[model samples]
Target: MNKLQIKYIRQMLGLSQQELGHLIGVHNSLISKIETGTANLQPKTEQAIITLFSEKGISDNDATVINALLEKRKAV
Candidate 1:
């Protein structure tokens, strides 16, 4: 997942980094680094994130678009 996607999904889920990290089996610091675009996530982590979005009725394409929108919001 891209940084934008990660940040948006976490926000949409109403989850703090520690909460998200607990759900995904990662450290809170790792989640922070990822959201900050300072970390490259492993493929397995990406797959898990994708699955989570899919369960939330977010298609892969929609996820991408949402990520783009979130990035635009961050830029503004």
Candidate 2:
């Protein structure tokens, strides 16, 4: 996935960099690097996040799905 997708997913899940890193078994600085477009996620880590998001009922649509989920979370 792209950096924007990663950023959007993390935000949609309302996770801080440290929280997201913990979820994906990475470092907080790595999450910051990815969000800032200075680094990339390995395929395995990407798969882990995709699994997590899917588990949370976030569909594999477009960025629109991410935005919708974020809004849905805020409503709750």
Candidate 3:
């Protein structure tokens, strides 16, 4: 997912960066770095985020968009 989508999903889930970080097994600052384009998410972390969004019932279309953005980011 793109940085904006990560932040958006976190907010939608009513989670602080700290909370999300805990769930994903990262420090809160890593979340901030990820959201700000200063860090890259490992594949496992990406899957965790996808699972989180899936559990929240994010639409298939939205998930597609997020995955597309992730692929694009990797290309960069």
- Candidate 3 lDDT, 19-49, residue by residue in tens: 9999878899999999999999778888888
lDDT per prediction?
Answer: 0.82, 0.78, 0.84
* Candidate 2, run of 10 with poorest lDDT: 62-71
Full-model lDDT, candidate 1: 0.82
Residue 45 displacement (Å), model 3: 0.8
List ranges where model 3 is wrong by over 4 Å.
64-76
Residue 36's C-alpha lDDT in candidate 3? 94
Whole-model lDDT, model 2: 0.78
Q: What is the Å distance of residue 17 in model 3 from its true position?
A: 0.2
Candidate 1 lDDT over residue span 1-76, tens digit each? 6877887877887888998788878899998998887888889888877887687777889887897887788899
lDDT of 2 at 65: 67
Q: Between which residue pairs do clashes occur in model 3? A: none
TM-score of decoy 1? 0.80
Alpha carbon lDDT of residue 44, candidate 3?
88
Task: Give TM per candidate.
Answer: 0.80, 0.73, 0.75
Q: Clash number for every model?
A: 0, 0, 0
